[model samples]
Target: MTVIRCPGLLNCDVVEVPHGLRLLAADGRSYLLRGLSADRLAEGPLPAPLAHALDRLGLLRAGPTRTVAVVGSGRLAIDVAEALRGVPGTVVAELSDDPATERPGGSWQLMEDHSPSRLTPDLVVICPTDPLGLRPVLQLCRERRVPAMMAWCGPASAWSGPVLTESRPGCQNCLDMAMARRDPLWLATAAGLTGAASCWAGRSWIAGQVAGLVAAGCDEAAWAQPTWASWTPRGHSSAPLDPHPECWWCCQSGPAPVRAESECSAVSSSAA
Candidate 1:
């Protein structure tokens, strides 16, 4: 396997200290190399043992560049894109249905075409202001077997995850089913809302959290269990989303055997 020095450390400054060489990376992180010479840090193939060590130390990166499509609108989407641009070996492209709206500090290319057929990203991060508007895109991703995750801020809350994929146990449809089950009027309530619901306070802190979640989800070796992170004014929390037995997306075989009403209540209470 070929391994190269981390691109984020390409412009790192190496200073000789009394005991070892200290590398100040471009991302403002510092590393201490006890015995290795600075010359060994060249961007080239590294021996297996050295590559393994450097990789463990976060000084090396291997694999092809990943293309990530960020689909959404508003400052949160742009902020997430900006944050992802800093990740090594990542290519980010922003896609929005509303091109007429102005996006500030959006240096990344805005793909005017919002067609799902035109995109083949390794992973899609959906953080649109109004998630309901992106339901069709989510369906397309499921059909194409493309991995995707969602991160967005609500009027008084923020959420991330349950990263969806072909083999994942749970999906957006399951989530919607669970929501509707928990609140019988959820679908009706969601329909009455307009695009105005997509706007949030635009907190930088929330953007960082959402971006971090999206970045972790991009990892190919990430955990397979479907979980979501949520934040409120009071604090933050996360929970695994179990697949709805009747979900048409994941439980295509058929609905699981129904449990007693008490048993159903227990399961819902635990998930809550």
Candidate 2:
């Protein structure tokens, strides 16, 4: 099997310490290479044992650079962008609803339009502070067949999950359907909500989780699963987001025919 240094480790600074080589990773972690030389590792023909060890440690693998679009506003979005910036081989872009507003000192460029046609990204990470703001973006992802992952904060909790994709069994609509089945009034209640929820305490933690998910999604062999996770004051819980049998999004023939915004809203309102 062909082995190469993990794309994530590409940005590490290789230092020749007295004892051996110390690789300083962007995340502030260091790896000590005892007998191996950086040049040899980079050049080729690594020993089988060494290659296996590095692969196990996630320091060696084959992966291409991925363009990831993060859509949303507020601290969580910024936090997710900041975390993704440290991940090598991942180009991060911020898609904002507001064209005039730009984040100061942000490393990534601000995309004025959230349209997938404008910037076709390998994946989209959505972590808006307000859950209700997700509808339009979810609709866009559905219409464009763009894969998306969502992370958000609730009044007293934080959530990351249900990575949506055209190839996946569950989409955001299925999630809404699942929610409606559990709580018949969920859509109505969600419609009434206004401002974003505050997740001051767990913003960074949830952002890290989302960033990690983005990284995993970039690997061809590590396709993200439609799983949902929630962090509450009480504890953490996670489960698979299965496709709803009656979901119009994934259960239909091809892709759900692009519907008008008002028509989509009517369907959701009726589902509730």
Candidate 3:
């Protein structure tokens, strides 16, 4: 019933459980606030990439809109949604009380459940597979046949999971595989820190990375972006487990495994 607005942003500002959204204007820019705490609102002057991403999303638009929902409603999601709000469309975010509980212990096991039936988004941005989350997302992308991007950087082994790196000149997979694999402890360390303090400071960087990947896919879906072609493996067929016609992963198919520039053209961008 109560509508509060700010700067050039549209949102509900009533702090406690936000009766509505508010938009605020500040030094030549607008911002939106909703079901958020003062601390998050104050974590201002967001990263440039993220701010650019927000501006692109139209953080100042008002009215109903079609939206692609982000699965994890973390601080990144909050910021992303705010940017989306400015757009002429909605950015529906699905939040759950417990994320860890729903996710699988093993990343692979978790991917098994990455089915479309489990979601209802025009486009879904699964958290990226960093040293922390990639294994599962990789497996899930294969199982769900969902296209995902590498959000977090990790051991080459993490990168080696199943996405498409080509072998035209050579197999980056084999190259990555030859490198020392990361210990589980490393995985934990990469995703470590799970509360507020980290969210405002460190986590945003990682989240911004993931957010960019997600938003890219969303934009591609919304606007038929051209599919970059490939000479070796076809796009989306980049999974390590995927049967490349001449993949070294399955067989020593190619001659001494030529090194392809890790462009991963095979893993074409397809967001849904």
Error of 1 at 121 (Å): 0.9
TM-score (C-alpha, index-matched) for candidate 3: 0.34
Cα lDDT tens digits, model 1, 89-207, are 55777776355754442322332235765557787777656534565566566666678776766666666767787766787666766767897666555555434453344344455
Candidate 1: misplaced stretches above 4 Å? Answer: 1-63, 99-118, 197-206, 214-220, 253-272
Candidate 2, residues 69-137, lDDT tens digits: the string is 887767788778877766545687887644464654332232324665466677788766555455666
Whole-model lDDT, model 3: 0.35
**Candidate 1 minimal-lDDT segment of 10 residues:** 104-113
lDDT of 3 at 91: 57
State which candidate, 1 or 3, has the greater lDDT.
1
From the highest lDDT down, the ranking of the candidates is 2, 1, 3
Looking at candidate 3, what is the lDDT of residue 110?
A: 30
Q: Any runs in candidate 2 off by more than 4 Å, and if so which?
A: 1-63, 103-117, 191-193, 219-221, 254-272
Candidate 3 ranges with C-alpha deviation above 4 Å: 1-67, 73-90, 95-123, 128-130, 150-199, 205-272
As a whole number from 0 to 100, the lDDT of residue 269 in candidate 3 is: 15
C-alpha lDDT (0 to 100) for residue 100 of candidate 2:
60
Query: What are the models' TM-scores?
Result: 0.63, 0.67, 0.34
